[model samples]
Target: MAGRNMNVYFQEETYSKIKNLVAKREISRFINEAVEEKLKQRQQQQKEELRKKLIVGYQSRIKNKKLQKILLTYGEMSWEDLSAKLEEQEKNDDNCKK
Candidate 1:
């Protein structure tokens, strides 16, 4: 990639630390590599977060489809039958918890 020249200012203490850690001839390369590494790490982190969000959204859509199917199956049933079914489901859930 082509590079551009830009001036960057650092605090005196920070500059001193870098000077201490790196030879003057290699300071620019050291800073460039550090910045590139940090950028890559941030990009990877964002990708992972996005992947997790996509998985959650996909699972939510699947759950909605399953719920829709259940509702459709019960569409022709009477209100009393639906209420009884709900009660039975709640009882089963309670039993599982116990």
Candidate 2:
């Protein structure tokens, strides 16, 4: 944990809930869980942005004709080689797939 600081903000009804959590000796645990979840969501968003940037960067660098040529060329390879190629392709393809 580095460069972390706290500032308090209150919503209309959540303070009592937080206070109850504190009285139960679970406030820190709850806060940590909330932080962990927020971090996870932020990380996921950053990952998605990076992926989008890479896709745009790659597409800007290569033409569709070139990509199609590469795929078609792989399609002509030996079955074992093609299977390996397809597996690799499938892994990368899965990243963009929801």
Worst 10 residues of 2 by lDDT: 1-10
- Candidate 1 lands at a TM-score of 0.65
**What is candidate 2's local distance difference test score?**
0.82
**How much lDDT does each candidate structure score?**
0.94, 0.82
**Against the true structure, whose lDDT is highest?**
1
Query: Alpha-carbon error at 29 in model 2, in Å?
Result: 1.0
Model 1: residues >4 Å from true position, as ranges? 67-98
What's the number of clashes in each of the models? 0, 0
